[model samples]
Target: LAKTTQPISMDSYEGQEVNITCSHNNIATNDYITWYQQFPSQGPRFIIQGYKTKVTNEVASLFIPADRKSSTLSLPRVSLSDTAVYYCLVGDHGGDTGRRALTFGSGTRLQVQP
Candidate 1:
């Protein structure tokens, strides 16, 4: 299984933009980069996913370079409520085997202040 790297913690003020970068040196071309955010005891929630280039939704944006070795998760404007643990996951989104699995490593704890 491939692994993703992220900081242990990040701090940001309210109304600030926070960009967290995750590195996956051994990421495969067939794999997709997915991000999930977890708050306190809750389970991780999907933020975004991309294979190449850029993908954006109502929550966040995912940016993958040409090499696919690394990706960035960008949060537009963060608030105190946005404080949570961010996870970078790399895996095959699906396969013809009729099964889909995604594993998330220990997450990056994000702290948002007033």
Candidate 2:
């Protein structure tokens, strides 16, 4: 597993775009970059994922540079409901045979001010 570093907090106005970046310089070859979003007490939900280049889903877009040392999660037109903690993880996805517990650290908290 690779260690990841992200911002502790960010402030954004309602209906504004927000981008959160995470660094993982020592990522392994089989490791994948995944982004998750959490609202208060709820469990984190998958936001986006990318090995390289850019990956866009309904909720967010993940941008990975060529070096694969870091990634950025882009949220368009964020609202108050989007205020939450975002986490970036770099690891191997254990489908069934390789199941493993996730190690979580302090994540980036985004505050949307109305």
Query: Candidate 1 clashing pairs?
Result: none
After superposing candidate 2 on the true structure, give the runs of residues whose Cα lies further than 4 Å from its correct spot: 94-96
Model 2 clash pairs? none
How far in Å is the alpha carbon of 51 misplaced in model 1? 0.6
Model 1 compared with the native: what TM-score?
0.94
Q: What tens digits encode model 1's per-residue C-alpha lDDT throughout 15-76? A: 99999999999997679888998988898888888899999999999988898888999999
lDDT of each: 0.89, 0.90
- Evaluate residue 106 in candidate 2 and report its C-alpha lDDT on the 0 to 100 scale: 90
lDDT string, candidate 2, 19-64, tens digits: 9999999987777899888998798998887899999988999999
Model 2 per-residue lDDT at 58: 88
Candidate No. with top TM-score? 1
